[model samples]
Target: MLIKSEQQLLNFIKYSPIIIITLIAILINSLIYIQNEQNFEKDLEIYKKNYIESNKRLTKFQVEKAYKDIQRERENLEHRLENRLKTRVQEVYLTVENLHKKYSHLEEKELLNIIKESIRTIRFNDGRGYFYIAKKNGFSILHPITPEYENNDVSKLKDSFGNYLYKEIIDHFKTEEEYFGELKAVKPNMGNKKFEKVTYIKLYKPLDIIIGTGEYKEDFNNEIKNHIIREHIQNVRYGKNGYIFIFDYDGYQLAHVKKEYIGKQRIDLVDSNGFMITKEIIKQAKKEPGFISYIGSIMPETGKPAYKTTYIRGVDDWGWAIGSGFYNLDMLKYLEAKKKELRAMNNESLKKTLIISLILSAILIALAFYISNILKNFFTRYHERIENEIQENRKKDMVLYQQSKMASMGEMLGNIAHQWRQPLSSVSTIASGTKIQKELGMLDDKEFDKGMETIVKTTKHLSQTIDDFREFFNPNRVKKEVDTQVIYNKAIQLISSRLTSKEIELKSDIDSTVFVTYENELLQGLMNILNNAIDAFENKEIKNRIIKFDIKFQKECKMPNCDIKECSQGKEGYITITIQDNAGGIAKEHIDKIFEAYFTTKYKSQGTGIGLYMTYEIINKHLKGFINVENSEMKHDTQSYKGAKFTIILPINIEEG
Candidate 1:
C-alpha cells in the first residue's frame, strides 16, 4: 500500500471549490478580455479606412492646387509676351508714319537723306539693320549701306529675294497698310551669302511711296529665348539627388540638367551609347495628366535610373504640351520609415492584449466557485427550520378535532331524548285508550277500526324516526351520489327533535329533483347550523320560533347570475338551502370571523368555535359548496324581531371519482 504524500494532499486542496471557482473566474475574465481586443481591432480598422480616405482627399486637393498654380504661371507668361509684341508693332507703325510725314514735301536728295535717317532709327530700336525706300514703279530710291542701288528697277531682279521685297512693298502701297514677311536678303558685295530675315513694309501714302524694314531671324530670337528658359529653371526645386528637365511643345528638349542636350530635338538626343531620357519623359507626360514613374537611361554623371515623376502642362493656344520631370528614388525613403513605426506599434498592442486576457480569466473563475459554496450552506439551514414549524401546527389541529367530536356526541344524546318523546307519548295514549275500551265493554266495530288505524300510524312514525337517527350516527365511510332533497330531508330530521322541544315550528320548501355527490358528514354539517338556529331562537324566548328550510335552484349565485361552468354542468342549477330562524341576529363584529377555528362568542361549554369552521371545511373542502349568513327582521302582526339567516349554497352535482 502506498501512502499519500504532502504534495498529493496539497494538489487535492488546490482542486477544491475555492480553487475551482478561481479557475472559472479566470475563464470569464478571459472572455471579457478577448472581447475588448476584438473591439480594439474594430476601432483600428475604422481608423485605417478613415486614414486612407483622408489621404485620398488630401491628394486630390493637392493636385488641384498644383494645376491651378501652373495655369496661373502660364497665363502670366503669355500676358507678358502679348504686351511686348504689341509695343514692338506700335513702334514700327510710328516710325513709318514719321518717315511719310517728313518726306511728303521734300526734294529727291532731301527725301533720300530722311529715308537713311529713318532706317538708322529703325535699326537702333528693332534689332535689325536692313531698310529700303521704293517708288510706285518698283524703282529703288534709297537703300541703307548700298547707295549704288538708287533709282534702279530692283523689282525686275530675277530672284526670290527681290521679288518678295518688291511685292510686299507694292501690296502695302495699294492697301495703305503694313505688311510683314520672311525672306532671303541679297547684296552684290556679299555674293552667295544668305540671310534669314523678317520684313515690315508700310506705304508712304501722301508721297506715293513705300518704305520697308528687315530684321535677321537670329537677332530677334536671341533677344527672348534665353530669358524665358532661365526664369523657368530658377523656380524649379529638385530637392537633393534629383534633377529637372523642361521640354517644348513639340517634345523637343528645351532645357535639361545636362546643358548640352538643350536645343536638340527629342528624336536626335539619343547617342551612340544609348543614354537618352527625353523620349521617356514625353511618353509618360502624354499618358497621364500628372506625376508617373518610368525607367530610362540616366545621365552618366548622376549614375541613377531616370525613373522619374513627370508633370505635363498643355499650352492651349498652340496645341502644345510642356513637361517637367523628377527622379523616383528620393521619394521612397520617406515612406519606408513610416511603415516601420506602424509595425512596431501593432506588435506591442497584440502582446499586451494576450497577457491581460490570461490574468483576468483566472480571477473570474475563482469568484464563481466561492459564491456557489456560500449559497449552498445558507439554503440548507433555512429549509430545516421551516420543516420543524409545520410539524408543530399539525399537532394542534389534531387536538382541536378531538374536542369537536366530543361536543358533537353530547348534542347527539340530546337529540335522541327529544326524538323518543313523541313516539313514547303516542304509545302511551294508545295503551290508555285500549284499557278504557276494555273497561267500558263497548268496543264496537267502528271503535275497533279507528283504534287500530291510530295504532298503525303511531308505529310507522316511530319506525321512520329510528331510521333517521340510525343513518345520522352511522360510522361507515360513505362514497355515493346522494340527491339534494335527500340531504336536506336528512338534515331536517336530525334537527326536527330539537325544534319540537323548543316549540320552534319547522317548515321546508325543498326541490325534489336536484342531486349532488356527498356523504353523511355533509348532512351532519348542515344539521349543526340548523341546531344552532333552534337554540338561538328558543333561548331568546321569542313568541314564535320558526325555522324555514328552503331548498331550490339558485338562479343567481353572484352578480349577473351567469352559470358557473364547472359547478352547473350546462344547466343553470344550484341548490340553496336557507335556514332562517326568529332568533336574534349575530353581532356585526363577530360575523366575519365566525368560520375561523377557535373563534366563537359562545361559552366554551355551550359551543366549540369549530362548529362553523368544520361546517365551512365540510362544504367547501368535501362537498364543494359555499355558506354565508345574513340578518333579517321578522314581522308578526306589525311587530318585528331580528333573526339570523344562514344560507347554504351547493352545486347541483359535485364531481366525484
Candidate 2:
C-alpha cells in the first residue's frame, strides 16, 4: 500500500502545473463572485439612502409649495383687513385732527362733545368698521361694539388669555404718542365669542382720549384659509404616501394626513433624539422652506413609532406651519429585493471587467488633465472681458453728467444778465449825475455827500446781487433749517427783473413761517420753474399775464396736491407752493416731455430744456420733495386763460442736527 501511495503522489506532481491552474481558476471565480455580491449590497444601501432622501425632498417641496400658496393668500387677506382697520383709524385721526384745527379756539369740553358725536356717527368699510375713544385712565368714552362698557372704567379689563387689554393701551400712551397693537375682544356678530383682534390707538392730545379701532384678526384669517383649503391646499399631493399637514406657528395642528391628529397641540412633542420636532417644524416653516430629519414619528400605515424624514414651511399670514414626511423603514424592503437580483448580475459583469481594467485606467488620467487646462483658460478670458466693459460704461456716464452741468451753467449766465441790468443802470445814472454836478461847478458839500451815498448804495446792491447768484450756483452739499418763505423770496428776487420787464403781474400768498432743509437747492429749483412760466408768456396774446403763488402749511401731510385739500384737509403737516401763470398753458403733447433734458418748447435762442430738468432733479433728488407741472385753465380777476401750473410739496420741518 505504501509503495502504491508514493507512486500516486509522484504521478500528481508530474501534472501539478495543470492541476494548480485549474484550481486557481475556481478560487478566482469564487473571490470575484463574493466581491460582486458585496458590491451589490453596498450599492443597494446607497440606493436606499438616495431613495429615501429623494422622497424627503419631493414631499417637502410639495408641502412647502402648497403651504406657500395658502400662506400668501392668508397674508393678502390679513394685509387687506389690517389696512382696512388701520385706514379706518387713520380716517378718524384725520377727522379729529381737522376738528382740532378747526375748533382750536373752542372750550375743551364743548370741542370734546362735538368730536365724540361726529365719531359716533361716522362709519367705514360699508359700516363694518367703527371708531371709539377711551381716556388715558382707560375710561371708555365711546365704544360701538360694547355700549354697555361705555361710561365704565376699563383700566382693569382683561382678555380671554388674561392680558390686560385696556390698561396696555393706556399705559402704552404714557410713553408713546401713537400705538398700534393687537388685543383680544368679543365680536358683536359672533355672539360675543372672544377672538384675537388688532387695535390701533393714538393719543388725541387735544381731548386726552386714546382713540382706537379694532377688527377680529382670526375671523379674516379663517375665512381666507377655508377658501384656500377648499380650492387648493387640500388637493396637493406628491409621492404615494406624501400629503400636506398644517399647524399653527404655535404647533397646534390644523390639518394632518392622520385625521385623528388634526386640531391637536403637538408643540411640546419630542422625537427619539429628544428634539422638539413640532416646535422646530413650526420655526423652520415660518421662514423659508427646508428639510428636516428626526428619529421619532407615528407611521401613517401602521400608526406606530418610526424614524421619519420631513419637509416643512410656514404660512406667515395665518401664523401656521405646514409639512409632510415619510418613514425610512417603508423603503427598506424594496431596496433589499432589488439588491438580491442586482448581485448575481454584478458578479457576471465583474468577471468581464478585469480584462479592460488596465486600458481604462491609463486613458482616464490623460483626459482629466486636458479638461482642467481648457476650463482655466476659458474662465480667465471671460472675467477679463466683463471687467473691461464695466469700466468703459462708468467713464461714459461721468462725461454725460459733466456735459449736462456745463449746459445748465450757460443758462444761469443769461439769468445773471437780466438780474445785473437794473443795478448796472442805477450805478451808471448816479455816476453821471455826480460828474455833471462837478462839471457845472455845482458840486456842493451836501450834494456831493448825497451823490456819493447813492453811488455806494447802488454798488453795494450790485455786489449783493452777485453774492446771491454765486451762492446759488455754489456746489455746496450743506443742509440747514430754512424758512420756506425765505427761499421763495430769494427765487423771486433772482428773476424779479425779468418778470417786471415782461409786464408779468406777480401775485403771492406765501406763508413765510414754514421751514425745511436744502434752502439754496430749493431756491434754484423754484427759480427754474418761475423762469419757465415767464418764458411761456412770450408767444401768447393773453391780456392778463398773471403769475400767482398759493402756499399753504400743514402739520401732518406729505406730497401735497390739489386733492390733498380734501385728503389732508389741513389735518397733516406739509408745505405746498403752487406757482401758476396765464401763458396759455403748455400744449398737451409737450407737457409730458417738458422735464426731459435738452427738451425745448421754445425757439433755440429763448431756452435750453435743461432748466426744467435740473429743476426736477433739485426738487426730487436733492430736497426730497415732489414737483409736477400741468396745463390748466385759470381765472384771475374774472379773466380766464390757459397756463402752466407747477406745484411743489415739501416736508414741514427738517432737523439740521
Candidate 3:
C-alpha cells in the first residue's frame, strides 16, 4: 500500500507539467482572441467619430468661405453700378457733342433743344433714368424737373442729403472735364421729395454747356443686387452637391437651384423626412448666424438621403437669409472597408500569438520530460541518502539544540549580571565607606541609618526580581496558594516607571483579593498589557492619556457574545480582568492579528512582536483562561476617547493545568 501511494505521488509529479503547459497555452490564445475582439470594437467607434468630425469641420470651412464671398460681392456691387453710370454718361456726352458740331452754325439753344428731345423718351434704371442739360455758368439748359430752374441759378439747388447740387457740379467742371457723384433731384411724374440719384456730367466745350444723365441710386442698387443673386449666387458651388442658397426673411427663395421654387414662398416645403427645412433655416437666421441640420436631397452616388448641415446667416440689411451646405455620405461602405482591414490585422496577430505559445509549450514540455527522468533516478537512491542524512541531522540537531539552550541561558545570566552590576557596586561603596568612617570614628548615626535603609530596600527589590525571572523558565509547574492582589501589585510595579515617564494616568477599580490564579504567569501577562499601553502613549501628543484597569467576579464575562465556554474551566464562577487605554486605538486592520506570534505594528527596533504572543500563551495555556481584544470608546469627565480593550476571563475555582 505504501509503494502504491508513493508511485501515485511520483506519477503526479512526472506528468502534471505537460497538462499545465497545454492549459496555459490554450489560455494565452484565448486571451489574445478576446483582447483583439475588444480592440476591434473600440477601433470601429473611434473611426466613426473621426470620420464624422472631419466632414463637419470641412463643411463649416466651406460655408464660411461662401459667406465671406457674399459679403465681398455686396461691396463690389456698389463699384459696379458706379462704373456703369460713368460709361452711360460718356456715351450720351459724345452723342450730344457730335450733334452740336453738326449744328454749330445753328443757335446754341436750338442744339440743346435737339439733344434733349432726342434722349428724352429713352429710359433705364427702373424708369427713373433721364438726361439733363446745364450751362457752364451753373444755369440749367434743360431742366428735366422743376422748369423754374431751366434758365435761372440752378447752383442754389440742394439734394435731400443737403448737398449744394449745381454748385458741386460747376465746381467739378472748373477742374475736371466730367463729374460723377451722388445727389438728389425730382424726376418726371415723381413726387416733390428729392430722390437720391447718381449723376454723371461732361463739359461740352464747343457750346460752353454740360451734357449729363442720372439714375436713382436706390433703383440701381436693387437691380445690381438682383443680378448678383441670379448669376453669381446661383452658380456658386463647393463640395459635392454644395451650393449657395438665398431666401428672404419671409421664406421666399431668391436664389436656388430649384428654379420653380424661386420667388415662391417655401416656408411650407419639407424634406423627405417631413422636416420643415426652410422654416428651420429661417428661424435660426432670425436670431443669429448659426448651423442647422436636416435630411436633404438624395445623393447620386448612394440612393440615400444626403444629410445636410447648413450654415445660415441673416443679412438684416437686405432682409435675406443666405446659406450654404455640404452633404454627408452613407457610412455603410466606409465601415465595410474598415472591417476588412481589422480582420486582416486580427488574423496576423492571432497567428503570431499562436506561434509563440506553441514554442513556449514545446520548451516547457522538453524541460518537464528531462526533470521527470532525473526524478526517477533520484528516487532509486533516495533511501540510502535519506538514511545517511537522518544520521547526520540527528547529530547536528542535538548539537544545535544544546547550543541554543546554552545561549539562552547565557543571555539570561548576562541580563541578570548587567542589572545587578550598578546596585552591587553601590552597595559595596556604601559598606566600605561606612567601615572606613567607623574605623576613623566619624560615622554619624543619621548617615548610618540612611545607608542601612537603602541597603534593605535594594536587597528586597533584587529578591523580587529573581522570583519574576525564575517563573519565566521554571521546568516544574505546580499550583500554589497565592494572593491575587500581590500578583497585581507586582505587575503594576513593573510598569509603574514606564507609565510615569510617559505621563500616562492610571485608573484602577481592581478590588483586592480577586481570584487571579497562576500568580507568576498572570503577573507576566498583566505586566505585558500595561507595558503595551504605556508604549502606545509614547508617540501620542495628547495631555489626558488614561489607562483603566478593572477586575471582577461574575458568572460570565461582560463579553455579551462570549464564544468561550466559561463553565468548562471553572463551574463555580468566573474572574474577568479588563485593561483599556486611550492611546488612540489599535488599527482595525491589525486588531484581529494582534496576539499572533511575530505580528506587530511597531518598527523593528521598537518591538520584538513576542510580548502579546507570550501573554496569550500564559493566559490560555497556563491559566486555562480565555482572552480577547477589541476597539472601544469611553467617556471620562464629559470627554470622549477611543482606544482598545483587552479582556481576560479565568476560572475562579482553580485547578492544575
For each candidate, what is the lDDT? 0.62, 0.74, 0.77
lDDT of 1 by residue, 302-408 (tens): 66555544555443443334554444443344344544555566557656755665566566546544654555555466657766876887789778777777776
Per-model TM-score versus the true fold: 0.38, 0.37, 0.52
Candidate 3 per-residue C-alpha lDDT over 175-200 given as tens digits, one digit per residue, 9 for 90 to 100: 78878788777776866777788878
Which model, 1 or 2, shows the larger lDDT? 2
lDDT of 2 by residue, 324-367 (tens): 88777778766867876786678568757654443453454344
Best by lDDT: 3
Q: Return model 2's CA RMSD, one decimal.
A: 36.5
Q: How does candidate 3 score on lDDT? A: 0.77
What is the RMSD, in Å, between candidate 1 and the native fold over all Cα?
A: 29.7
Say which prediction, candidate 1 or candidate 2, comes out ahead on TM-score. 1
